[model samples]
Target chain A: MRIALGAVAAVAYAVLLLAPLAVIVYSVSPGAALEIPPSGASLRWYAGLADQPRLISGLFTSLLLGAIATGAALVTGVPAALALTRGSLPGREAFLAVLLSPLSLPGLVLGLGVLTSAAVLANATGIRTAGTLLPLVAAHLLITIPWVVRSVAASLESTDPALEDQARSLGAGPFATLFLVTLPSARAGIVAGAVSAFVISFGNFALSLLLASGRTVTLPVAIYETVDRYQDPTVAAVSTLTIAAAVGAAVLTDRISGPLKTRDSSARSGQPAGPAALEPNR
Target chain B: MDRSRRRVAGLLLLPALLVVAVVAAAPIGLLFRVALYPPGPVAPLTGGPELDSFAGLLGAPYPSVALRTLRLSLLTTVLVTLLGFPVALFLSRSRGLSRRIQTLLIVSPLLMSVVVRAYGWMLILGRQGFVGETLAALSLPRVGLLHTEAAVLLALTESFLPFMILALAASLDRIDPDLLAAARGLGASSARTFFAVVVPLTLPGFVAGASFVLVGSLSAYAIPALLGGSAARTFVMEIYELVTISFDWPTAAAASIVLLLFASALLGGAALLSRRRSARTFGT
Candidate 1:
């Protein structure tokens, strides 16, 4: 009964995730080529995407924005994580909340806030910040940094703070202690956080839409424009690419994080776990 | 080792804090400030009344838009939470590779662009989309799912389901297996054991997931704009058009203020509900 249940669940999930993409793939049915199930398939739409300069440029812009935002997030998030966890700073809990508050704040409100501020600056000083790549990067950084902070913070929680103290007592400076003792222990978390941040910035569309203009469109916004204007298989091709990246990153992260431990053992092991791994009884 | 290091750490956080202030807080503060002012484009910066925007927003189209937003958000919250509960429960019951697959399946949506996901549903639910064709095949009356409240609801549910599932799964995992066993050993059926044992303990997850989904959907623009069509509008869609297309910054800011207030109120309600659930669970 359990096996049957599991099998059913798996198939349901597979269909839920794959069926939509399959629909798009099937739409590309060419007149002369072999057809896919549920309908015919064609390569013409796939060929058409190659000529969409906006789509191509949008892809480049998205990649660049993700790279910049993720890079900024790592730099900022890593230090914040270190200070919050390792340091004996006063009001550590308060600082942590402030860092993580972005997780709770609605992105729509945040985007509007940023836009409003840019408008104010332009109004006051004749300085325009809207529809620029910089604003897009900044907006994404606002949303993406929290993931790294949480990931690094979780990793830091698992590590023995005593190790840092021991190194300090053994005559290492604060910087050396962090580099030698603390960082090594939380390397997995940091790497995982960076990867997560990269995927997040890459996948982000909301900020890109509000901040991007003609030359600055991201892939998601481009796809949005294309679909809104023309209901064709090109949208499907782009969606397929996105789904592939999202699914691939998720799977890769799971592989990197390794297997879930039994509840008691995982708690005993003191390893920082992701949201999915925290299931009761592991 | 003393104050200097502490100060250094404090100073190190300055850049990040600056980014937050300029990027996050400034915009929010501006939203509130402009919301209180009059609408209809600023007249150069010479000198004008500060509260005109607020008056404009309270008048006419703004109030109606705000009310419509509240109605749509309430519906989206209810639907997402209801659908997510069963899925989250189903996830908590899996193990080994099955659990991994479920987790991947659930979280993968978060990785895809929201716009792309919205677009995917557009193809599926639009007049000429898959759902329409499926209905046609069944020889059923043609059902127009797109450009309706139902369309918005479906897209919101899909976009927010991952959040609910993750939250519920997190909270459910906190349940002690022995408690379930004890319930069963007492001759309780699986269904009773699940309801009496599992649901009570995982209320936190439910609250967390529901709140996240609610806040997310409340401020949602992409799904509504894409699926809901021009006539089927939400507040966020209204705000976006007002600011960008209409170039009505003051009214946009005012609308955003209303959205901000609405979001905070819903979030507060979720918090209170969560606390009450926790207290009740512990009291027993």
Candidate 2:
């Protein structure tokens, strides 16, 4: 009875998650409208991607943007997360909340806020700054900082602080202790955080819509422009590749974060993958 | 000694603090000031600013747009919770290989960018899309949901449901098996065991899951903008339109403040609910 019930649930969930993806992937036909069990199949649409140099360049732009954003997030968010999680700072909870405030604002509001601030600065300083990468990176940093902080904080909170004390007693200085002892413990989380941050920054659409200029189009923005102009399978082909890259990152992160606690009877029953395994990461 | 210790900790945090100040805090502060400092019908900063832009939001088109955004998010949150609960339950109970496979399967959409997922949905929900053809094949009067609010709702639900499921599964995973076994051993039917023991224990997960969907759906821009169409503009879409198309910075800033307030309220409410739940669980 339980097996049957689980089967039913699995099927339902899989169908829900995959229906749109399957239909789109299967229905890509050259010069034909999308249909499930498409009357014909052609990789012509996939081949068509090469014709759009803008999208190819946009893909590179997205990777570069994502990398920059992730680097910024890790550098900034890690120390802050460490301070909040490990240090005996007063009002740390309040500080944590403030740090995470960006997560509470929609990307549109964040984009608008960043844009307004950039304009204000530009006007005040008498500089032309609307189309620069500085604001775009800054805006994405806001979007990704919360993710790195939260994940690193989670790993820190769960770790034994005594280990750090032990490392210090063994004569490791603060910097050495941090690099050798503290960071290694938080490696999985930091990596997971980095991967998710990159995904979040890369997949981001709204902020790019506002912040990206003609010279700086991200993959998401390019997809939107392409789909808007021509409702064809070309967009699907692009989307398919985007999905492939993202899924690869997710699967790779899943492995790097470690396997589910299999072969342990005591830990057997619960969600095989813990919170870190399934975090939206955005 | 205490001051020095505090200073070192502060030093460690300074870089991140500076980044946050410039990135999150300054922008939001600037947004408020810009919104509040609406220029009069003259050169900039000539007259003392008033809350006219905020007052402008109380006008006709704004209210409907605000209402639609909330309505879509609310409906999506509820639907995701309903659909996510069972999958989460099934996921938490199963073991080993099946569990990992199920985990990957459920989160596949989550791996895709919002733009990619939205594009995929556009293909499936369009007039000549699969759903429309399937309905036609069944001889049901042809129905096209794309370019409508329904399409946006479907997209949001799909986008946010994985978050809900993950949260619920995490919470459900923590539920003590002994407690469940006790309920079942007491001659309780499976349904009774589920409700009497499982539901109450999983309430925390349920709340967390609901909060995830609520916040996620509320903050989403891509799903609505991509799937919702021109007429079905969301708060984000409206804000985009306001700044880009209309070139109304002051009003756009004001509108953004309103949307931020709305999103914050949802987060605040979720935080409050979770706090209360934890208090009930832990406090005597």
What does the interface RMSD come to for each candidate? Answer: 4.9, 3.1
lDDT of 1 by residue, A51-149 (tens): 878887888888888889889998888888777776668998777667666666656667777766777788899988776787788888877677777
> Each model's number of backbone clashes?
16, 0
Which portions of model 2 miss their true places by more than 4 Å?
Answer: A1-8, A19-28, A35-40, A260-282, B1-6, B37-48, B133-142, B184-189
Candidate 2 lDDT score at position A266: 19
Name every residue pair that clashes in candidate 2: none
**Candidate 1: clashing residue pairs, number:** 16
Largest DockQ belongs to which candidate?
2
Residue B71, candidate 2: C-alpha displacement in angstroms: 2.0
Error of 2 at A233 (Å): 2.5
Q: What lDDT score belongs to each candidate, Candidate 1 first?
A: 0.70, 0.74
